[model samples]
Target: MTNENRFNFNDALLTALFGTPSRKNTIDRLGIVCPVFPDEELRKSAVILCERIKKMDDFSWTALCKMAK
Candidate 1:
């Protein structure tokens, strides 16, 4: 029902295409420089997280995080 976006998609694309704003621009903007976790690292971390999360009561491997809106 609400957005939790950190950066606008257009701004992100501009940042990717042109890099960060120049000092003359003098305005704050959000952008992606690099992934926080690369593919291998993300896979490993997800494994660990899933292992821990499975210890919770009444959790199921096939369970959906949320139903479709």
Candidate 2:
């Protein structure tokens, strides 16, 4: 598949962290900032996301998109 169509772990983490791509308003509505949580809190969140990333090889574009919500 072309790079544009690829869905990887990094993309999932970003979506989970930053919310939907190119939907700044939605993110704003959700109150998700770059550092949504404090560093210590974020590290705890990262642990959960890391487990998710390890369990899945990749995700469909639609699945990644849902991560935004």
Candidate 3:
């Protein structure tokens, strides 16, 4: 998929976790304002979790996300 069509975390994750984008300023204030990785513990945990999830087959990942909701 192209970048626009790809399931970007900015598009999917934010919408899933926080809802939709609704900013009109210089900053595209969309979704929950998640902090970037300076917060080491959270960042590390997320990275590890993502790595684990990434290892799952496509069907499993899709199911996991579906069930998570």
Model 2, residue 19: distance off in Å is 9.2
Tens digit per residue, CA lDDT, model 1, 1-69 = 645332334323433443322311211221122223356644443333333334433323113221100
lDDT, candidate 2, 33-52, per-residue tens: 43455566554544444344
lDDT of 2: 0.46
Error of 3 at 59 (Å): 0.5
Q: What clash pairs does model 1 have?
A: none
The model with the greatest lDDT is: 2
Ranking by TM-score: 3, 2, 1
lDDT of 3 by residue, 1-69 (tens): 454223444334433553322222102222113346466654444444444444555565555455434
Instruction: Assess each prediction's global lDDT (C-alpha) against the native.
Output: 0.31, 0.46, 0.40
TM-score per prediction, in order, is: 0.28, 0.34, 0.44
Cα lDDT for residue 22, candidate 1: 36
In candidate 2, what residue range of length 10 has the lowest lDDT sum? 21-30
